[model samples]
Target chain A: MKTVQNNTIRNGIKVALWEIRKLVWNKAFIISLLLTPVIWGLFMGLPRLFEKIGEPAAAPTTYIYIVDEIGIYESLSQKVSDIDNLFLRKHSGPIDDLRNRIEGDENAGYVHITEEIFETRLISVMTGTGDTHIPLAFNTRLKETLTRYELAMHNVEAGDIEKIVAGYFVSVSPVIEESVDPMDRVRKWVPPIFAMIIFFMVFMSGMTTMQSAISDKRDKMIEILLSSVSASSLMYGKIIGNFFAGLIQLAVYLIYALMFIHFLGIPGLGHIPVHQLLSYIISPELPLLLFFALAGYLLFSSIYAGLGATMEDVMNAGNFQGIIMLLPALSALFISPVIGNPEGIIAQIGSYIPFTASIVMILRITLIDLALIEIVIPVVILLASTMFMAKLAGKIFRTGMLMYGKEADPKEMWKWLRQ
Target chain B: METLLNIRNISKQFGKNTVVDQVSFDVHKGEILGVLGPNGAGKTTVIRSIMDIIRPDSGEIRFNFQDNNNFLSQIGYLPEERGLYRDSRVTDILLYLAQLKEYPRDRARKRVLEYLAKFDLENAGKMKIKELSRGMAQKVQFIGAILHEPAILILDEPFSGLDPVSQDVFSEEIRNLARNGVAVLFSSHQMNLVENLCDRIFMIHKGKKVLYDTLLRIKQDFGSFKCEIMSEENIRDKFINFKETEKIEQEGLRTTIYLKKGVEPGQFIQKLPDNISIEEVTIKRDSLHDIFVRTVTEN
Candidate 1:
């Protein structure tokens, strides 16, 4: 009893240390964990810095020159006050001379108003530079003002004009019974980003697990290990070890993200409506999400462990890792849509899926005011699926760890499982 | 002494090919049983089966433990393919493996350092496995296997990559383990080492045990007979009457003869010329390599 207890404790400690060492020492893990965050911080932080630097520069006031003899200068000046950043400059000359003067001047543009014999009003805009926002804004406002003047001259009422303008408005609100929280827009983007980070952490950590499993098989280290512990114990130890290492990375990233947000003096982070953030952190669905995350890690990692065992070389292990990595990555594409409409059928169905549910369900818990039973149902479903998946993965891992040389086929795996 | 391990008729097959055919072996208290075979002769397969890395299709592996009933803690194995986590320090890996064998942290550390010192690798303990030479890695692997003072030690091709000095050091270690009453089974392709070190050998060819006995007995049973003749009679033709006469070579006035089976050396000498100029007629024994090749090929 003492010896077995001692062995188990020792095995656990060793596994934990091995995992921590690999995470700390591996170049890829270090680069992803340390360098990637720094790089992202620098890249994302540049825009804010540019905005700060340009904030003090005074805006150049807009200047517009008119070349029309239509006597519309008084009406245009009244409309120019309503147009943002437009200032009218009247030039007394023939239209050709006004156009020449306008083209020669670098800071102003000419708007020529004309009337054809058919009694149709014509407007042409001439500018030296096509890229300036002021020229485009001025020309659009001038045209609207002239059209309104022509309508008013035809005895059009002001109420009619309001109606016409209102018809052009596009409403973005969906026809839902419940009022959508404005914060839902921001919340929708958060889940996918969180899922992406988790995906990266799982993938990089899964690679470490793969290396451990394959190195054992290649070097016959598995034999030495098996002589000291059960196959299940070893597999479980490796999974737990890697999970803890992943938690370390997650914690580090969270700390860095918090520091970044704090350093940049971004508002709304400090005032994130404590109730909403707390609801996210302490939701009843959180345990379920964590459970699923653990289960998903084991399920995916078992495939890698099996691959590592079945293959004779490290190079072949990489080929097997693609499937393990792709399953979670493919699930990530649906995270955004699911978060946008978490109460939808697609999101609810995804909440039952082992890979998608962890992110999808957590997102629903945070972004949607779901009923208690609805939340409980998905959590239960995911937990059950996670259990079943873990059982299957464990069986596959045990059987696959002994195989070598050739890749393990489904038939052989089934046979081993049955035995 | 009680039996530590009992491997009863373990048979393993890969598809239709039987790799370990109804092989039965046992390890008792303090015995170093050397398993000798050529490449692909199922030595490694049997070792893996014993370690439970690969399950034998049909076999019963019963372990009779002492006060500690956990069989895993009592067995130490070094596989044919040597490996370590290339990124981990030597001492860390050793301590981890010792821990797997159920050693406590302080004890594991002390034991690992002691083994490192014993192997002349103490200075290299802090370095990673990748930084060590192949010989040094092999030493570390050996330390990993035996650090927990396991009751049964199984080593497959442990000496394959070791230099002469390292091989000697490993030999001494194996001997020391045996002296401390640990059952040790080591597989090797080097028949000379087996001949020199093993108390008893189990020689398998094509997954079947062809010979399992003491080294002296195997040498005696399967050895060839060689005789030198220094006769001036030119009587090579006279020896043709012997039915088992194989090859007779003439060097100047002397003749050396190799006799075939079923012909006794005493009987062949009985027919030789007496009172001749025979300076010496010594019969030489066969080497283990010769015996292995002949036995494997003949079987």
Candidate 2:
């Protein structure tokens, strides 16, 4: 009996390998698998290229036209020169001429130093696209210079001006603090992309599971299979087969993605100062990511196998599979924000759930200082859910594989489960 | 003889229709039991129920083996629907299926090669199932079922879609298995083959067993003694004189007589005149096909 059982398992593996080989060699599977990474690489590369083309060649020299009778121009030039990499070009021209040149040249912008119109003691400043750091820093320096000049006209000491500016700085710290090192900011994106990569691999490999199950039934091969091996064994063998296949593809994508990023000299990639990028890529999270990936792969692939068994053909599996496919993709869409704020209610909630946990947990691990308990809790929960789902899927597979000509409904599945 | 398989009061219903009703039969060791029925006659259903493919509404199937623990592993099944993993190579698929039936890897490999060679499919073993012709694929399916050397073999419609040569090969293989004491139960639409191969037959019609007996016994019990007489005189005028004769029909020069129940061929022969030359005298028991039709229509 033990020998018979061993043969059953060995045969199960053989069946699984046969399934994988067929799928791997199929033209459609090959084309679809290759297409995803190529398209993703192109999309990731395109935007950086466009940004490089449209950026200004060099920073424009800072010029301010002062019309104030208080004579604050000299102090402002000194303040502008204090800022690193900022060159101050003082122009004693009409305000209208300054405005025309600033508007005409694309790289240039202007700041007018005049008495405030809205407030009594403040200065009015204007610039184009205020979002840049250069203009904002320049504006702050000019304000400081004017305030010191106004005080000096009343015989206030220059050292007291420094004291006053220092008094205005507040030491504000983040409320939801994270232990992420400042230099590791680039590492934050890796988890989401890693999650996406895993998701893509699992999804594509799941197509193999579906195809194998459907092909077996469609060709009437399942009857022979069932007569020899139990349906549960066949189902598990298929899921495991695809799981290994998924891991292979994922391994290739990891190598290819890193090489591609390195070859293209992506900014803040491998050459980053924090953890050498390569170390971060090989972080402890990698094994955890693999763990979660296997869990996620088995969970989804088992469901896919069940759906495949229940469906009359591969085409009929689409609507059922669409629901499963949308799950991880949808989780990936929301994973970024969750990573950014792991302590948030949504991330905390999603981390505990199986479908969302793989992406959410990876993202959280990268961006936040998660406790051992925090990490283990979701892993345990996801592992438990995977086991339960696999059991349910096995039952469904056993019942559904034998049924033909009609799709199994949820109620019927529930009934089978009861049995 | 020891009963290898006992199916007791098995019945199957699909929705509102009963497909198999109270069907009971047993397969004894070293015997080939033919299940003969028309289309929708529950023959396949009976086979499936025996395999436990579908749960019967009410039935119990018991198999007796030397070791009870190994009973399930000792049975081989071939469904009417031919099923082989289409993308897999013939040898790999056969070995895989054999393993599922509990054959070890080396043994499975050896058996697979032997069976492929036996079927003249040695070179085709490495070919994909999709690349094989329908008949070749069917042979592969047959090998998958029996590769493990099962004690009991159940095949449904094993002769369908086979060339006469292939059919001969299949029949010879089945005979060898039976000679080796492997109890075989097969269902087929080919009445002639069943008539030749079956020791005993169970005829089903509309979810019920119409007749179950040995071929000789069924013929002896339900058959008519037929005689053809060539006579220039009108046989219709003398037909009433013979109380043993009924429903005699004449066409051209041939006269056919249907012997009534309890009528003996010897008694009928004695009544013939010395001048009347009996061109042919045949005790025609119902052919298996005729029995199948009569059984189905009678019920």
Task: Give every candidate's TM-score on chain A.
Answer: 0.69, 0.64
What does chain B score (TM) in every candidate? 0.84, 0.86
Worst lDDT 10-window in candidate 1 chain B: B273-282
- Looking at model 1, residue A323 earns an lDDT score of 66
For residues B151-227, what per-residue lDDT tens digits would candidate 1 score against the true structure? Answer: 88988888997899899999988998998999989788888887777877888888888888877888778877767
Model 1 stretches with alpha carbons more than 4 Å out: A1-13, A45-103, A108-200, A218-220, A265-280, A312-325, A329-405, A409-415, B13-18, B38-41, B57-59, B220-282
TM-scores of the candidates are 0.77, 0.73
Q: Each candidate: fraction of true contacts kept? A: 0.67, 0.54
Q: Taking the tens digit of each residue's C-alpha lDDT, what string does model 2 give over A1-419?
A: 69667655765687677666766776776786778688888898789889999887665554444454556767777776656555555557787877766664444455555555225755555443353225567778776777676667678887887787666666767899777565456565665566657766887677678777877778887767766666776887887788677776677666666666666655643343333556666666678776777677777787788778777776665455557646656676666678577799989888888888877777777677888999899989999988898888888887777776777766777777775
Off by over 4 Å in 2: A1-11, A24-183, A186-196, A261-265, A270-291, A317-333, A336-341, A348-354, A369-385, A409-419, B9-23, B55-59, B66-72, B205-210, B225-258, B266-282
lDDT of 2 by residue, B1-299 (tens): 98998889998887679999998989998899898888998988887766655678998888888775545568888888767766778987777677666678898888888999999998998899989999999899888888898889989999999999999999999999998999999889898999889899898888998889888888777766676777666665566668888668888777877778678888887887665555564656557776677667777
